[model samples]
Target: MASLETRVTEFQENLARNSVNEIKEQIKEMQKMEESQNFVLKDCHEKTQNMLKRIVELEKTDFDDKFNHITRRMIGEVVREHLTPIQMNFNLENKSIKKLVEEHAYTIEQ
Candidate 1:
């Protein structure tokens, strides 16, 4: 009877030890997983920051390009508006001078 009781007590102790060891191993594995997740999260954050900066740069470039294009178009329109009448007057004077030269040549030939 005493021998059987001792065997039961030893068995219980062994089971308890095994349970404790398994729990400890699980805790260690969880800690390792947590560390791995931290690294992955850090990497994702850095990449996101880089992408955001690049997007901002692209937006700025696009805005500048649009602004420059609009400025050039406006300047060109203003120049055309200011030059149209001058061009017309120059054309009229050129025609008048040509007519006068032709008349002068005809008199000379006569």
Candidate 2:
């Protein structure tokens, strides 16, 4: 009876040791998984930051292009508005000068 009790006690000790080892191994595996997840999270964060920066650059370029186009169009409109009448007046003056020159030439010929 004593030998049988000793054997049972030994068996229980071995089972407890195995359970402790298994728990330790499971903790190690969880730590490794946590490390892997952290790495992926860091990579995703970097990619997101890069994408946001690229978006900002693209938006700035687009805004600048639009602003330049609008400025040029406005300048063209202003130039046309201010210069058209001046050009027309210069043309009329040139015609009047040519007519006076022709009249003077005719009188000289006579």
List TM-score per model, in order.
0.53, 0.53
- Per-residue lDDT for 57 in model 1? 90
Alpha-carbon runs more than 4 Å astray in model 2: 63-110
lDDT of 1 by residue, 10-65 (tens): 99999999999999999999999999999999999999999999999987787777
lDDT of each: 0.97, 0.97
Give the poorly placed runs of model 1, Cα more than 4 Å off.
Answer: 63-110
Give the count of colliding residue pairs in each prediction.
Answer: 0, 0
RMSD of every candidate to native, in Å, equals 6.3, 7.7
Instruction: Determine which window of 10 residues in candidate 1 has minimal summed lDDT.
Output: 56-65
What is the overall TM-score of model 1 with all chains considered together? 0.53
